[model samples]
Every structure is written in structure tokens, then in C-alpha cells.
Target chain A: MLELVSQMFSYGFLNRALLVGTLVALCAALLGVSLVLKRYSMIGDGLSHVGFGALSVAMAMQLAPLAVAAPVVVLAAFLLLRISENSRIKGDAAIALIASSSLAIGVIVTSLTSGMNTDVYGYLFGSILAMGAGDVAASVVLSAAVLVLFVLFYNKIFAITFDEAFAQATGVNARGYNLLIALLTAVTIVVGMRIMGAMLISSLIIFPALTAMRVCRSFKGVVITSALVSVVCFFCGMVASFAFSTPAGASIVVANLSAFLLFALVGALRGKLPG
Target chain B: MALISCKGVSLRYENRLAVEDASFEIEAGDYVCIVGENGSGKSTLLKGLLGLKSPDAGSISYGDGLEQRMIGYLPQQTVVQKDFPASVYEVVLSGCLNRRGMRPFYSPAERQIAGRNIERLSIGGLRKKSYRDLSGGQQQRVLLARALCATEKLLLLDEPVTGLDPVVTAELYALIRQLNREGVTVVMVSHDIVCAVHNAGKILHMGTGVLFYGRAEDYPDSEVGRRFLGGDHHA
Candidate 1:
């Protein structure tokens, strides 16, 4: 295991995967806390589906997949919010509608294009080859932007998440914060899809957040814990995948799932103990 | 001058009217309770005063230095709010967001206000406790502390006590009453007409019309108030 681990880090592709994976894990986890509390966590899934469809189209058009997918996914997120608010469909239902349609579009487009892209399997599942040098640089910049914005608006975000109506009443501009959340979630989902695969990216957004909640009693604690847990889980899962020849994305999700179960048990045990 | 005055206000949720042609005045330092049955627009009227909802027909004017963001608001019970992941201190300090403007962090003055409010509400011990795990009364106290951090001039509470045992309800009422006595002008919405009559200096009864709006003592003697309260005066 030590030999395999040491050899794995020697490959530049594996090194890039670890770098972007850790960055995205941190970004997704930070945004996940707010999205989960707002009951908008599924937006990650919906946006990932939108991103998959956009990526397929971008590939077909011979364009940069990330460049095309980011804006389209962001727009889809805002559209989802509007549809949920202004139409008869609620948030979850809107997500399902858009997500399913985008998934179908991605599949249909992928089949029609029939491009000799070897990375389709990687895109569908997960692959260490997903992270190239350009992708790593872009991921770093995007992840840093997410972190800076989150810190800058931390107080406003807390105010809106707790009680949007109250926040708006107190001149907090609830709509603006909601938009910020949507934008950040959209960007994180798009970036995370590269490493986690479109099918499994939302787990990165969700698992760390829910897991952190079991042990964390405050918003700040949950955010910090989630960031740390997500990065650590990504590394562990990636290492395990290399050792066991398993799918990278699934391995990471399984790692997150195990951590969640462990924390839940700990939380339950703590609950049973007398204060 | 009155702190706030509403003239022929009509508030709506979509096309349905929540408050219709309502008119009233709240003077500085007044402890007003809006009493009404469900769907009678007590909440809507409060929203109109807080500038959340626009009056379709009338105008709401502010005086005595009241602005849209300066007033503290305690919203009614919501399942989403109850499940929020925050400490008691975080929740209380969030009330200072209005004063924060476009700044990124809370100022020392805001933090001091939050600290004082927590002490004032006697929830200093629960400052680090998770908000969701708290009992109903304790949660209300935390929210009350949050509202206090927002404003000392005026506080608006929508159904401040919806569910709680008799003891907790009485305790919350005492805390709110004490705050009012300390000169924080309060406008609360409650279904408990008895407490509204008991604790409030003025009663704003909202219904199909502006049924009664005056001193608490005058409500029972008024024709509409007697019909609305069903002649029950038990406190």
C-alpha cells in the first residue's frame, strides 16, 4: 500500500487530480452548508445535469467544455429558481424537470455526436485523467473566487439563510444573496463535475455538508468542518481508488458516506449520554 | 408625532386581500398588540408597517426616526427557521446585519449590542447552543434577543408565542412586557386575546375591517371588540 501510494503521487496526472479535487471539494462543501440549510442542495444535482448537457453540446461544437458549461449551468440555476417561484412547480419539482431533461439531452447529444472521445467513460463515471494542467489552473482561480466571495458575504448569507423575509425586512437584500448563492452553487457544480463526474458531483456538495451537520452545532463550525472533511475524504477516496483499481468518483462518495455514518453514530451516542 | 400611522391601507397576497383598507396610528413608546383570528391580516398589517408589503390603497408613514431597516421583526413560527444550523449567538448577532451595510464583518459596536441583548434576554448561557435543539420557549427567547440587537426603538413580533406550555408562555410574556416597560416600543401580533388585553397598552384588532384600534381598556367596551372577542375577558 505504501509503495502504491508513493508511486501514485509520482504521476503528474494523479497529482493534478488530487490538486483540483481538493480545491473543488473545499468549494463545494462551503457552498453546500448554505444550500443544504435552504433546502436547495438538490440544485447541485440539477445544475450538474445541466452542465452535462452543456458539456456534450460544447464537445459537439468543438468548444471549451468548462467555458460553455459554466454560464449555461448558472443560467439554468437561476431559471430553476424563477420557475419554482413564479410557476406552479415548486423547487424540488422544478429541479427534477430540468435535471431529467438535461440528462436526456446529454445522452441524446452524446449518442448523436458519436465522437471518438475516450474520456466519455471518465466523464460519466470518474477518471484521474480528467484533470489537465489548464483545468488545474482554472480550478484554482475559480475555487479562490468562491472562497473570497463566501467570506465577503458571510454575514449577509447567514442572515438570508436563517430567515429571508426577516433579512429583507432589515434591508439585507435577500434577493441579492439568493442570487449569490445560486451563482456560487452553479460554478461549484460545474467545476466539481470534471473530477467527480456529472453523475456523482452532487454527492460532494451534499455528503460533506450533511456529515458535518451531525457533529457541528453552528454554521461556522459546520462550514469549517465540512471543508476539512471534504478535502480529506477526496484524498482518501482517491488513494483507495488507486490502490483497489476502483472508480475515482464512487470511491470518494463512498468515503464521504462512511464518514457520515461514523459521525451519525457518534452523534447518536452523544445524544444518549446524560449532559 | 406618532411613530407610525397607516391610512386606508390595503395589503394583498397575490390578488387576495390580506389586509383591507386598514388605518391606525402607533405613538412613540406604545405597546401595541394586533389581535385577530387566522387570515384576518394581522401579519399582513405588520408587513405593511415594516415595508415588506405595499398597501394597495393607502399609505404608511414613519416618524420619530423610524426607517425600513431600523425596526426589529420577529417572524412567526416556521419549520425551516426552527431547523436552521446556527448557534444562539449567531442567530442573535444576525440581527445586526442591517447596521452592517455593505461591509463584510460585524463592527465592535454591533457585537457589543448583540452581547448586551443576549444578557438582557437572559440567554447568555445558551449563546453557544444549537438553535434547533432548543425548546420552543428557548428558541423564542433567542429570537427575541436577536430582534433586540436590531433596534431599541421599535420591535415587531408576529405571533411571538404560538406554541408553548403555560409556564413558557407566561415567561415569554413577562420578558416582552419588561422590554416594553424599558421603553422599547413594541407591536406584537398574537391570537391570545387575553394576553393582548393584559400586557398591551394598546390593541389593534384586525378583521374584515379595522374593527378596533385604541387603548386596551377601550377594546372590550367597543361594539366590534365585544363581538370579536366573543365577550370573553379572561386573562
Candidate 2:
């Protein structure tokens, strides 16, 4: 076990994957608390599906994946917001409409190519070995930007998420902050989908936030605890992946799930949760 | 001059007239209560006053040193909004966001304002508690504290005591009365005409238009007031 662990660490690919994985995990957790509280958690899922569709098209057209997928996902997030705001279709229904359509487009593109690229499959379910040096750098830069933006507008975002109408009444631009959150979610979703898989990245966003909420009562407490839990979960999941040869994304999700269950039990025993 | 004035103001929901040709004046330090039936455009008029929505025909203007920053608002909370996962402290501090301007972090003066409001509302102990875990009464108190932190002059409350029990409602009304006595101008929308008339200096009753806008004591003799609050005087 020790030999295998050291060998995994010796490889540069594994080290880069862990670094980017931890960064993306932290960003997702920070943004997740706000998104989950605002009932916008599914935006992550929808954006990931859109990212997948864009990536598949990028692959088919022989374009750089991140360059193509990032802008496309951001645009999709904006479109989703507009549809939910202007039309009769509400948030979740609009997400479903966009997500399923994008997923279908991805599937159709993959089949049309008739060459099921292993690399594309890796993105579908996440592959640690598939993260190149460029993917690591791009992910780190974009994820760091997301983290910085969240911190800069932390209080404003809290105000918007907790009570948007009141926030607007008090001269805070709720729509602008909401749009910023949407953009950040889009960025996090695209970057995370590359490593966490399009199918399961939302668990990374949702699980840590929820687990922290079970125990932490305050928003600040929840955010701080969620960041801690997400980083630790990423580390443990990577270790598990190395040890047990499980998939990285699934392993991390399982780690987060275990943490949530443990916190739920502890919260129940402590009577922290109200009936 | 009136702190806020609405002249022939009207509001619409999806191009259909909801509030038509309504006009009223909120003078400085006056507690004005607006009462009406369920869909009587009381809230829509309040929204017009707050500039949350644009008036279709008339102009609503602010005066007597009330600008965008000088007005505080407490919106009616829906079920989902009530379950928001914020602390009393965080929620209160956010009221000072208008004063924050372009600063990324909250200044110490804002913190002082939040602390003062928290102490004023007697929610100091619950400052760190989750907003969702508090009782409905406690949540309203926190929200009031938040509104207090926003502005020292005018407060606009929309059905602020909608779901609270009778005892809590009384307490909230008493708190509002104290603020009004301290010279904080107030404008509120309510279904509880009885209690609203009891505390408010003036009453604005609307059905389709400006039914009655006069002193609370004179509302009983007015034609619209007679139809609305005929026998029931207290809530």
C-alpha cells in the first residue's frame, strides 16, 4: 500500500490533479452554500450538462475544450436566468429544459462522430490520468478567480441570497449579484466538470454545503466549515481512489456523502436540527 | 413638504391595471397605514412608493431629505424566504449595505449600526443563531432590526406581522409605535385595519382607487371607511 501510494505521488499528473481538484472543490463549496440556500443548486447540474454538450461539440470540431466550453456554459447560464425571469417557465423547469437539451446535443454529437473518444468518456465520468498540464493551469486560474470574486462580494451575496427584495430595497443590486453568482457557478461547473465529471460534480457543490448546514447554524459558519470539509473530502477521496482503484469523482462524492451522514447523525444526537 | 408624495399614481400587473389613480402624501415622522382587501393594490401602491415598480401614469417623488439611501424597507416574506439560512447578525448588517456604497467590506460604522439595532430589538443573544431556526416572531424582530439599521428616517413595511401570533403581533406593533414616537416616519400595508388604525396617525383605504386618505380618527365617518371597518373597530 505504501509503495503504491508513493508511486502515485511520484507522478506529476497525480500531483497536478490533486492540486486542481482541491482548488475546484474549495470554490464549489463556497459558491454552493449560497446557491443551495437560494434554491439555485440545480444550476450547477444544468451548467455541467451544457459544458458537456459544448465539450462534445468542441471535440467534434477539433477545438480546444476549455476555450469553447467555458464561454458556452456562461452563456447558457445567462440564458437560463433570462428564461426563468421573463417567460412563464420557472427556474427548475427551465434548467430541465436546457440541461436535457444540451445532454441530447452532446449524445448526438458523440454518436455522429462514431468515435467514442476515451478522453471524452473521461470527462463524462472524470479521469485523473486525463488531466494534462494545461488543464491544470486553466482550472487553477479560473477557480482562483471564482474564489476571489466570492470573497470580494461575500456580504453582498449573503444579502442577496438571504433576502433579495430587502437587499434591493436597501440599494443593493440583487440582480447584478445574482448574475455574478450565475457566472461564478458557470465557471465552477465547467472547471469542475473536467475533473469531477459532468454527471457527479453537483454532489461536490451540494454535499459539503448541506453537511455543514446540519451542524453550523450561521451562514459564515456554514461557509467556513464547508470549505474545510470539501478540501478534506477531496484529499480523502484522492487517497481512496489511489488505494481502492475507484473512480475519482465517485470516490469524492462518496467521501462527501459519508461526511454528510456522519454530520446528520451527530446533529440529530445533539438536537441541533429543529423538527 | 411631504417626505414622499404620489400624484395620480397607478400600477399594473402584466399590463392589467392593479392600482389606478391612487394618490397620497407621507409627511415626515407620520405613521401611515394602508388597508385594503386581499388584491386591493395596497402592496402595489407601496411598491410604487418604494420605486420597486414604476408607476404607469403618475409620479411618485421623495422629499424632505429622503432619498434612495434614507428609505428602509421590510418586504413580506414568503415561505421559502423565511427559511433563509442567515444569522440575525448577518441579516441585520446587510441593512447597512446601502451606506456601504462601493466598499467591499463593511465599515466599522456599519457594524456599530448593526450592533445598535440588534441591541435595540433585544436580539443580542440570537445574533449568531440561524434565521430559519428562530420563531416567526423572532424572525420579524430580526427583520425589523435590519430595517432599522438601513435608515433612521422612513420605514416601509409590507404586512410585517402577517403570520405572527396575536401576542407577537402586539409586541411588534408596540415596537413600531416606539420607533414612530422616536420620530421614524413609517408607511405600512396591512389587512389588520383595526390595529393599524389604532397606531397609525393617518389611514389610506383603497379598493380600486383613492377610497379614503385622511386622519385615522376621521376614517370612521368617511364613506369608504364605513363600508370597510363598519362595526369591527379593534383587531
Candidate 3:
């Protein structure tokens, strides 16, 4: 197993894929802690659907999917933020509207543009095995932007997550920060689509955060633990995919779920035992 | 000096008026309690005062040059899902975000302020505990501590004692009164009219709108106050 892992890492394509995946995993996990704490896990799901729709449209137009998907998904996220701010429609409802509509639109567009792209399966289920230098570069730039923004607005974002109204009362500009969060999530989803695909991206955002929460006592601890978990899961899943000839994206998600369930079971058993 | 003034403030949600033509003035250093029924627009009034909601046809203004951070607020204790993992200290420190500058890191001064507020509220021991794990009273205290971390001038509370026991309620009220005595202007909404009469110097009797705003002594004799306060002589 170690030999196989070493050989995979020695290859140029595999090396680039691992580097890109590690960067994205770290970025997603850090932001995922805030998303999970704010109870907006569904926003990740909604944004991924928007990314998928953009990808289908891009495919038909012969444009780069990531470039097309990034702006479109970010715009959709801004609209979701606006609509949810109306006080009439709650956050989850707004996300549901976006997710369902985008998914429907994407499926229709994909079917209409058939025969043009025979290898479109790579975009759907993901194919780290087929990653190129271009994909690696894009992922690195996007992850760095996300990381910088996260650091710049950590305190305000934390305040907004705990109690939005209170945050506003304290002069945090809650709406502005909320819109920023939505846009960041949108960008992360677009970048992450190449690794996890739209169908499985939300799991990448949620599982690591949930596992971290079970053991971490502070918000900073949760962020660190989640990023570590995502790194471990990505590496293990990548190697496992190589060894077993399985899909990379699906393997990563399975690894994440396995880690999540293991932590949950340990927590439960510890709870049952006498202190 | 009147720090906050509302003139014929009527807040409406779509077609329904939450608060109709409410006029009142909150003087500096005054402890005012607002008492009303469930749908009496108590929370709505507080929101209007905080600029969270715009009044349909009225004017509201804060004292000139009063820093926005000087107005602290303690919303009702919401039952956040147990899955939330924020610690009490983290929650309280968030109130200092505005004062922490636009930088990513908290300054030592901001940390000192948060620490002082926690110590003042007497919840320093629970700083590391999860917010959701705290009892209702403890949660309220933590929120109050957070509010205090913002400023010491004006505090607004919305139904702060809803789910706590009488003992805990009394303790919280005592703390509020103590803060008021220390020169912090307080505007609080409460369903307990009796408690309001005992603790608050001024009472705003609200039922749909501003029914009466005056000293508690003056309110107990008014017709609107008589109806809401059970027409009792001591009310």
C-alpha cells in the first residue's frame, strides 16, 4: 500500500491533483466550520447546483466551465442573500428555491447539448485522475482568495453567525458580512466542483465540520480540527481510489462519512459510560 | 437629556400594524419598563428604536454624537439548536467585534474589555462552557455580559425573563436595577406588570400603540394601566 501511494505521488499528474485537492480541502474545511455553525449547510448544496447549471451552460457555449460557473454561481448566491433578507422568506426556503431551479435548468441544458461533450462525466462525478496543470492553477488561486477573506472577516462573521440582530446592534454591518459569506461560499463551490462534483460537494463541506464539532471546544479549535480532517480524508481517499480503482470524488466522500460515523460512535459510547 | 425620541412611530408589517402611532421619549439615565400583552408590539418597538425596522409614518432620532456602540441590546434567550458549538466566552467576545477594529485579530484592549464584562456579570467560570449547555438564566447573563461588552450607556432588553424561574428572574432584575443605578439607561420589555411596577421607575403602558408613558406612580392611576394591571390599587 505504501509503495503504491509513493508511486502515485511520484507521478506529475497525481502530484498536481494532490496539491490542488489539499489546498481546496483546507479552504473548504475552514469556511465549513462557519457554515455548519450558522446552520447554513444547505447553502453549500444550493451553490453547487448553481455551479452545475453554469457548467452545463458553459459546455454548450464552448467556454471554460470554472470561469462560467464562478460568476454565475456567485451571482445566484447574491440573489439568494437578497431574497432571504426580505424577512418574508427564510434562509432555508431561499436555498431550496435556488437549488431546485438550478438543478432543473442544468439537467435540461445538459440534455439539449448532447453529443458535444462525451467526457462530461468528469465534471459530474469528478476525475482527479484526469486533472491538468490548468485545473491546479485555478484551484490554488481560488483557495488563496478564500483564505484571505476568511482571515480578514473572522470576528464579524463569528458575531453574525451567533446572533445576526445582535451583531447589527453592535454595528457590525451584518448584511454586508452575510452577503460576503454567501459570495465566498459560491466561489468555494465553483472551485470545489472539479474535485467533488455538484452532487457530492456539500458532503465535503459538512462532514469535516460536524466531526470537528464533536471534539473541539472553541471555534478556532473547530476550524483547525476540520481542516486537518479534510486533509487526512482527501489524502486517504485519493490513495484508496488509486489502489482500489474507484472514483476519486466518491472515495473522498466515503472516507469523510466513515470518519464522521466513527467519531459519532465514540462520542455515543463515551456518553454512555460513567464519568 | 432625551437620548432616544420617537414621534408617532407606527410600525406595520404589510397590512397589519404592529405598533400604531406610538410616541415616547427615553431620557438619559432613566430605567423604563415596557409592559404589554403578547402582540402588543413590545419587541417591535425595541426593533424600531434600534433602527432594525422603519416606522411607517413617524420619526425616531438618537442623541447627536452618541456612538452607535453605546446602545447595547439583550434579545430574548433563543433556544439555539444543541448542535451549535460556540463557547460562552466566544459568544460574549463577539459583542466587542465592532470595537476590535477592522483587523482580523482581536487587540489586547478588546480582550481586556471582554474579560472585564464577563467578570462583572459573574460568569467568568462559565467562559469555556458551550453556550447551549448553559441554563436559561445563565444564557441570559451571558448575553447581558455581551451587551455590556459593547457599551455602558444604554441597554435594551426584549422579554429577558421568559423561561427562567422566579428566583433567577429576581436575580436578573436585581442586576438590571443595579446597572440602572450605576447610570446606564435601560429600556426593557416585560410581560410581568408587577415586576415592572416594582423595579422600573418609568413605565410605558403599551397595548397596540403608546397608551401611556410616565412614572409608574402616574401609570397605575391611568385608565389603560388599570385594565392591563388588573385594576389593583398597588399596581
- What is candidate 1's lDDT per residue for A24-118, written digit by digit as tens? 89999988988888888888888888888898888877899889999999999888767655645677887898899997888788778875366
lDDT preference between candidates 1 and 3, better one:
1
Lowest summed lDDT across 10 adjacent residues in model 3 chain A is found at A114-123
Give candidate 3 misplaced runs (Cα > 4 Å).
A90-97, A116-118, A270-275, B79-82, B232-235
Candidate 1: regions farther than 4 A off: A1-3, A86-88, A115-118, B232-235
lDDT, candidate 1, residue B8? 86
Predicted candidate 3: what Cα RMSD to the true structure?
A: 2.5
Tens digit per residue, CA lDDT, model 2, A1-275? 67876887898989998888999999999999988887778888888989999999998898999999999999998888676566576778889988999989998898899567786688689888767889888998999899999999998988888888888887787788888988998888888887788998888899999999888878898999999999999988988998888999999999999999999898888885455
How much is the lDDT of residue A222 in candidate 2?
A: 90
Query: Measured by TM-score, how close is model 1 to the native structure?
Result: 0.96
The residue-by-residue lDDT of candidate 2 on B64-150, one tens digit each, is: 878866578988886556666678898899888888788899989889999999999899999888898899999988889999988
Q: Weakest 10 consecutive residues, lDDT, candidate 2 chain B?
A: B226-235
> Model 1 chain B: which ten-residue window has the lowest total lDDT?
B226-235
- TM-score (all chains, Cα) for each model: 0.96, 0.96, 0.93
The residue ranges of model 2 lying beyond 4 angstroms of the native Cα positions read A1-6, A272-275, B232-235
The complex in candidate 3 yields a DockQ of 0.63
Query: Residue A98 lDDT in model 2?
Result: 86
